[model samples]
Target: MKWPWTLQPFIFYPQGGGQNGDQGWLRAGAEEWTVTGTRLDKASGVVWHAVAGELPPVDTQLSGEVDAHSRLRQMARHTGEHLLAQAFARINPAFEVAAVGMRGPDCTLDLRGSPSEADAQVAEALLREVMVAGPLTLETQLVPHTELGRYPLRRATPLTGDVQLVIFRDTAGELFDVSACAGTHLPLGNLAAPVTVLGLEHIRAGLTRVTFRAGPEAAEYLGEVYRSARALAQGFNTGVAELPERVEALRSERDRLAAEQSRLRAALAAALVTAAPVEAYGPVQLRVLSLPDAGLLPAALSEVPAGEVRAAVAGERCSVGSGVPELDAGALLRAALTVSGGKGGGRAELAQGQTQQPEQFLAEVRRAVAEKASWSYVCHSRR
Candidate 1:
C-alpha cells in the first residue's frame, strides 16, 4: 500500500502568533516515532516537525498526531480572548484590540484604552452569551485591502502582497471579531466553556491588559479560590460573608480594654496617698509607712506635705520630703533599706527603696536618718 501519511491531514505549526504549537507522537504502519519538538520556519511559513527514532527516507510518508489536550487548552483560551475583546469594543468604541498573544495556560489581549468596572461587566456578560451560542465557524480568506473597510476588521497597514485574515462567526450569524490571527481554534464555539475574567491591569497611559480563563481551567481556578475562603472563615469562627464585620468588632473591644486598664492604674495611685501617716524623725517630723504593695508608691508620694513630711516605706518604700533640703534623704533611705538586699534610689529629698521586711526597713530608715541628723547637730553645736 502507498504510504498513508496523507490520510491523517491534521498539521500543527509552532509559529502560531496567538499560541505555541502542539507536541506529541506520530505512528506509521508498525513503526512508532517520538515527536521531540516543533518550530515554524519564518523563511517558508511552514512548520518543521522534529522527531526521534528511526528516520524514514526523504519522501517517506508518516501519520502526524498532535496532542489533543494541549490543543483544546489553546483553543479555549484563544477563542475566549476574542469574545472578551468583542465585548470591549461593544462597551467602548474607542477601545481597540492592540495585540493578542497566547501561552499554554492562558491568553492575553492588549487594549488601546483602559476599561471601567461597567465596561468589564459588559465584557463578562458577552462572554457568557458566546459560550451558550454553541459551535463557531472559523474562516480564513485573502481579501483585497479595499474590501477590508466593509467589516469591523483591524488592520495595521495595507498589504502590498497577499493579506491573510481570520474571521470568527457564531451560530447566530453574528461576527465576534475579525483579525489577522494565525492561531488554532475550536470548530464549535461551545467547545470553550464560559470564560471568567481573572483580572485587568493598566499597563501604560492608554493600554490595558486583560487576562481570562475558559473551560475546565476556569472551573478549577474558581474551586481553589472558594476552598481557601471557606478554610479562612472556619478558622475565624465566622460566616464567610461576615469576616470583615467580625474583625472590626474584635478591634473595637481591644481598644476599650486598653482604656479601662489606664483608668485602673490612675485610681490605684490616688488611693496609696490616702493611706500614709505622720511620725517624728528625731527632731523633724516625717511620714513613714510600709506600702501594702509597690502599686501604691505613686499615690503615697503625691500625698506627702511639702517640707514637714519625710516619708519612707520599708517593704516597698518610696518617700518624698518637703523639709531638710541638705539631707541626702533618698540616698539615706536606700542605704538603710539595703540591709534586706533590696535596691532603691531617688533624689536627695525624695527617694524610694524596697526591702524584704517592711517593719525592719521602716525602723532602720528612721534610725539612720535620725543618727545622721544628730551628727550634724553635734557638729553645728561645737561650731
Candidate 2:
C-alpha cells in the first residue's frame, strides 16, 4: 500500500538519485506496518512509502523509525561514490559519470570515457588521500535553479525549481564537491571505512563501468579475498607473497615434462613402425597396429610406408593414414566406423575417431581393405 506522508515530519529518505530508499517500521496505536521501501513520484513531486500490511486510517497519527545502521552504510557508500567520481575527474575531465547505481550489493558508475589502468590507479590513490586527510563536513543547501551557476558541479542536472546541493568540504572549509542530489550523505569522518575498486569493464561503445564497494562491505570483500589467497598459497606450501612465483614455476616444470614425454613417445613410435608387419592384398599394402599409448598414434601413422594404408588403435582412439593416391584413408575409416557405430572424420590422407569395440572396428577396416585391393595376391612381411 502507498502511504503519502511526505508533508508530515518524516525521517525516511525517499529513493532518488541512485540512492536506495529507507526501510523501517511505522506504528500507530496497536497496529504496525513494515515500510518496505520509499519512493518519490518525480512527476508529481510526491513521496510515497510502500508498506506491507493493513493501511492506517486517514490522518491517524503514526510514528516511524528508520534502520539507522543500514542508513549509515548507505550514506557512507553515497559519499564514497562522490569522492571516487571527484578523484577520477581530477585525473581526466572526460571521465564524467554517465550513470550510477548504488542499491545493489556493490555500487557502480558508468563513465563517458575509457580510463586506463594508470588512470584508475591514480584515481584510487587520490581518493585514499582525500579520505584519510582529515574529517570533512558534508552539508546540503536548497538553491534556486537560477543560482546553480554559483557552484561548479561535476555533472549537469536537469532539475528545475529548488535544487538540493550535496556539498563536501575539508576541515579548513575548502570545497571538495558540490552536486545536485537528494540522496543521504555522511560526514567524511563518519564514513572512514575502507573503499575498494572491485573491477572495471567496457559496458558499451565509449563507456566504461567501474564497480566498487565501500564501508563495511569493502572490508568484508577484502577479507574474503585474503582468505582465498591464503588457502591457495597453503596448497602450494608457500606464503601469499610467493604464491604467483610458485604457480609460474609449476607451469614451467609441467611444460618441460610434457616436452620430454612427447620426445619419448616419438622414439617408441619409430621403433614400433620399424617392426610392424605389412600385409599385401593385390595392388594394395595394408598395416594395422594396436599401440598402448594414444600419444604414439600420430607419430606411428606419420611413418607409413609408400603405397600403404595404415590404421593404428590406442585405447578407444584410432587413426588411419594413406600414402596411395588411389585409396582414401578418410573414406575408408568413415565406412569402417559407420559399420561399427563409432564417430570420426578427416581428409583423404588422414582420419581419426573413437569406438567402444576396437576389435570390430579393426575387422571392418580389414574387410574394407580386402575389397579395395581385390583377391589377386595376399602375403605378409616385415622390412
Best candidate according to TM-score: 2
Model 2, stretches more than 4 Å misplaced? 1-10, 29-32, 46-62, 189-192, 234-238, 261-338, 342-383
lDDT of each: 0.67, 0.83
**In terms of TM-score, how similar is model 1 to the real structure?**
0.56
Q: Report backbone clashes per prediction.
A: 7, 0
lDDT of 1 by residue, 1-383 (tens): 12222222347547466677676677768877666556665685555666665556666667777778777887788767766777788778777887777774556778887886667778888767766766567777787777777767743544545566777787777776687556666666566666777778888899888777877687778788778878988999878788778878989999999788667755865554445555554455666655556655665565445445455463444554445654666766666667645777777656666566766766666776677666766776789
Candidate 2 on 3-100: residue-level lDDT in tens? 65553445888887798999888888888888888987779877789888677778878899898878987887898788788889989999999998
In candidate 2, which residue pairs clash? Answer: none
